[model samples]
Target: MSWKGFSLDSATSERRRPGASRVTAVKILIAGGFGAGKTTLVGAISEIPPLTTEAIMTAAGVGVDDTGGVPGKSTTTVAMDFGRITIAEDLILYLFGTPGQNRFWFMWDELARGALGAVVIVDTRRIEDSFAALDFFEHLGLPYLAAVNCFEGAPRYDAEEVRQALAIAGHVPLALFDARSRDSVRQTLIAVAEHALRTLTAGRPRP
Candidate 1:
């Protein structure tokens, strides 16, 4: 909720482990369309209290912002959300959640600069809303996985069906998760990390 003690500069600084084990810090982006739950997912899984830049929705965004599918939503992330989680003693993940509105997209390039990979959260109710995120990561050639956030009362589809609908590459990992659950989100993050590692490995030049 507040970033009083945390700064991006300090958060990304090298950390030392006093023993033989070394610590590796990873940056990950949480991206998706408006109201797709990027904020919620980060908050649920973050070990530290997440930093959020949410603002109340107003009449000024009436025509520019679309909230039809998420009629009850009244707030939006105006900037990025920051959070940290330790996957292991040697591995820490720093999450950056991008703002979903078109006007804030210019910040994506910066948020994604050092990110190892991304998790594209999707809402089946507005499945089409996820296309822009998919395209952006694909164009950047960044390794990422699609995560379908199963909101209550929303129509459900199996993983394969959703994958086909999204038209993602067959090898890309696809997962179904409840964004509100810490366990579910943790599993999703692990999946993306593994997927990204495999992708990096496969692309390395053979010795």
Candidate 2:
């Protein structure tokens, strides 16, 4: 397949068996507000070593970046986080994590190109921080799900409460997940994948 003039192939040079199924690669985006755990989710679920572009926090961002809720955050994603996971023998997922800071938002359009869907990670402590990401995907008409990153010390709310707080549509899938848990992250990814599939199906012209 081709994305932005770049060709991407999941197959290798070696020959495959007569009955073997060809692998399919799908791109997915992990996006949310600052310090919402987009990077953590990608790293935890990635089968290979995750590629991170984190840079240390500095005085340069004093007034520009907001660190109120997450005072202990010492670094931020300067560009993007990249990872890969093989969901099944014939399916692979390429994860791209967008930088949470607003300054890097210009790159989101490029990162979102050809993406199947997105997972918007929300921190209950600062739920408002996620509104921008939610609005972005909604405006783009992209299929996305909301995942509440269960951070320790943050107040926990039921799915309905979060759904109301975010003002998301009833059809949008919402779930709780721990960014550090591989199993939890995997389930969230599966949910978004299923949601995207359903969305695409609904948009297709009936035969």
Candidate 3:
């Protein structure tokens, strides 16, 4: 399949017949501020129907939940989003999307345990909303990629400009994507995986 602009090889290649016992699983976290498309992304790329724990917005959150940039949003994730995708015959990715509201932030540490890396989705209209998520990953020293989710009417910024605005280090990868597209989501995942792999190898002792 073609993701972003690159073609991916067939996942059927280099695989044992059905029932092979050598499959490897990698955990990936999808994190962002409220209304940044975390749930949308997990649903788009999951092989199975994604599991979500969304609750309707109500008067109770009128003053507490910040709905400035996402005025139309009516639901929020209370727990987490879960999904799975098989990128290759032997490689499976387990996706866990964190709850975006600050009240739900306590769940992040549990979800991040054993995760290979994360994709921090950003909404250009509410760029500052993502700061907490970015700081969370940085403080843990986790390798991650910042993915700017393009939305209709949102201002467009070049990669360097976004990097500078977000104060992302030169080593971290940054890219743009449409979270609703399967190809785009796959491409983002590829970037995260590549970044994590590089960081892992770099920390290892040379042979």
Candidate 4:
């Protein structure tokens, strides 16, 4: 949220290397429900090969996860996925994708520490699945944006309706997104970060 003052610019020529930078890294968590494409979004924009701990699916996972939402996704994020992107020569956004299951919910706060904000992915086909993610963000009081993942058979709802259903302000970012597309994911990231910046700059609410 308060980054340009924190990290290097987008040009990034000053750093010369990935890990070398005068500015501190800006952390951002990408969170959502199981099969919500958290890993996909991370891979889409990562400059490096994403460090994913995905493995082959087992029969035990059947009926446990919504395979219908992720076709050909034999592997899932076990712990977390890490990637980095340079927003500007002055800022670097480091992204961490949380494990995609309710059982892993307890790890969120730890993962979110020092993070600017989050991009909560929602699968409109399974609207109920997104509640946990939204609730987590609201509870953490982090500025976030909801990105509706465009899935097959996903319900068609206007942004306003989704906002009201989620009990979020209309100004909150809720946009149609396809996680597999680099440009789409990048846009979603920008929107959430921008919201966090605005909220940070606005500071505490008035009495």
What stretches of model 1 exceed 4 Å from their correct place?
A: 1-14, 204-207
- What lDDT, from 0 to 1, does candidate 2 have? 0.85
TM-score (C-alpha) between model 4 and the true structure: 0.81
Ranking 2 against 3 by lDDT, winner: 2
Model 2: ten consecutive residues of lowest lDDT: 2-11
Model 4, total clashes: 10
Q: Tens digit of lDDT per residue, candidate 1, span 37-144?
A: 999999998999999999999999999899989999999998899999988676788999999999889999889887778999999999999999999999888889
User: Residue 76 in model 4: shift from native, Å?
Assistant: 2.2
TM-score, every prediction: 0.90, 0.89, 0.89, 0.81
lDDT (Cα, tens digit) per residue for candidate 3, span 1-207: 211221122211133457764555677899999999999999999999999999998899978889888888999999999999887655677899999998899999988887778999999999998899899999887788999999787899998999999998899999899999999999899889778767765772211
Error of 1 at 154 (Å): 1.1
Candidate 2 residue spans exceeding 4 A from truth: 1-19, 204-207
Q: Please, what is the whole-model Cα lDDT of each candidate in the order they appear?
A: 0.85, 0.85, 0.84, 0.75
Q: Clashes in candidate 1: how many?
A: 0
Predicted candidate 2 versus true structure: per-residue lDDT over 69-181, tens digit per residue: 99999999989999998776666788999999989999898888878789999999899999999999998887899999996898899999999999999999998999999
* Candidate 3 error regions (>4 Å): 1-21, 204-207
